[model samples]
Target: MVDTVSEGGAPRRGRFIVLEGLDASGKSTQVDRLAAWLETRGSHVHVTAEPTSGPIGSLIRQSFAGRVPLDDRVIAALFVADRIDHLTNARDGVLGFLERGIDVVSDRYVLSSLAYQSGDVGMEWVLHANEVATRLLRPDLTIYLDLPPAAALRRLETRRGIPDRFEELERLTRAYADYELAIEMLHEKDSIVRIAATGTPDEVAERVRAAVAGEL
Candidate 1:
């Protein structure tokens, strides 16, 4: 469902794009670049991340850190709850910007839910939960930055801050393998364009932009 809005008394609608991958897959960098490129191209754009840093997002983050221990199913539900809130806010935020003809892009979306939760449950269940939670707000395009587990670990090591519990996960080989499986599952029904995330930021962003545009 699309929420149309008017910015400064001008009417417009926004396009929703999602970028997904495991940690260090260069999602953040590419999301930012896409938003900037969209703006430069005269499109109004808003960039956001999940867990959204909102109240729901905060709880999910805490749960992730083991600060608040919840069952895996509950944790998955919390993540979806955060998306409902984030999407609402994102809708409102984008509508205002879209009224000015802006596009909205997200660093991580339902795909992340599928990848992470698929590890816990079946891909079908993860997809079902996300579908129910998002009210089926599918992204127009999903750019999956595919990186090998070792390369991802390299990027993780160079990351500036202490790793979060998920980042500290040493079973990344399993997680990565799980991600690949999730990708296959999603490709069954959506436009999931895979890009090599093994290059420089600009290079990866270039590949992503090309893939997004090509898919769109």
Candidate 2:
């Protein structure tokens, strides 16, 4: 239903696959690898990420970088606006690509907001804010790169000279717990696959490939 449409004589849409993980869990790297694999298998691919380069998304990044101080609730609200734009904008929006039969692989989607925002505000508030089932386009498949918070922190220190506001150990731990809850709650509707993220980037990509093969 999500990755395909069979109604109103519309063209067959491509799959919307999402890669989710805490900071430094190799999400960006895997997004590339997964897209490459899908292309090798002959599926046209479009890769994107949340906190897009759009106006609203730019504001969100400013907040993440500590350049713009904002309340947690405010940031949560920005995500909703950013996400809506990410999907519907005619210029390179996700729906535009998918509607044209090009597969879309995103680095993060609604699940990231659900997990990270809920860590700051309660889950009830985030759920009420997003209304994901109705407002956002749920991913056809979400592959979670499961890594311990401490390990992710280690990577952050070495990979980036300065950590962002959401890079704390406590926040990362809470986000992981939130991910578990979100996965359990949406498994039936979202078709999520959890792969252990401890290993080389190529190792994790292999697992991601296996999980995606099942859905394709």
Candidate 3:
């Protein structure tokens, strides 16, 4: 395991990296690529995603499928609950891995909640709900894959054959606007970097690597 010791007696925590973007922004693909790259460089990496594979996540998935009819505020609340569980679960959780000196890379994080949920619920309420989660598990780095809403919709249509609740053109346009506001509202602007996602997977990966070159 990699050594992480702070000036104090306690061990320094491992890095927490997050990938955020609208639907079909290639965040999932790049999360895997970044994890593989970190492993090759001898880092013990733990990869996870928000809307985690837990009870809350299950409800979120059902909501997406129109099976679970939750209001926007309830959906956002479930996201926060799942995120807390993902962080605090003793086994197979993000914090557990990080405490053991393993770097964590998440496919999506609080920024995504801010972007998507804020569109449905008002920004003030969404931000308040996420405040505790963000304080507890803020990413060390957040790479935003920037793509046009129309382009993202085309990609989803071509790849998935069916669109999910959040993949529509109008919602995506609004989500992008919320993302901009979220980025600006973040306490540390330097923690986030945007990369154009208008190229092949390999090309986008290259830009992601370049953006976090120093950390790597």
Each prediction's RMSD over C-alphas, in Å, is 4.2, 3.0, 2.2
Task: Give the better candidate number (2 or 3) by lDDT.
Answer: 2
CA-lDDT, candidates in order: 0.75, 0.87, 0.86
Which parts of model 3 are misplaced by more than 4 Å? 1-12, 187-190
Candidate 3 to truth, TM:
0.92
lDDT of 2 at 150: 95
Residue 50 accuracy (lDDT) in model 2: 90
lDDT of candidate 1 over 149-189, digit per residue (tens): 77888889897855665664555666777778877776766
| Per-residue accuracy of model 2 over 150-179 as CA lDDT, tens digit each | 999888888745567878899899999999
Best by lDDT: 2
- Candidate 3 positional error at 170, Å: 0.3
Instruction: Locate the minimum summed-lDDT window of 10 residues in model 3.
Output: 1-10
- Give the distance in Å from residue 206's predicted Cα in candidate 2 to where it truly belongs: 0.6
TM-scores, each model vs. reference? 0.84, 0.92, 0.92
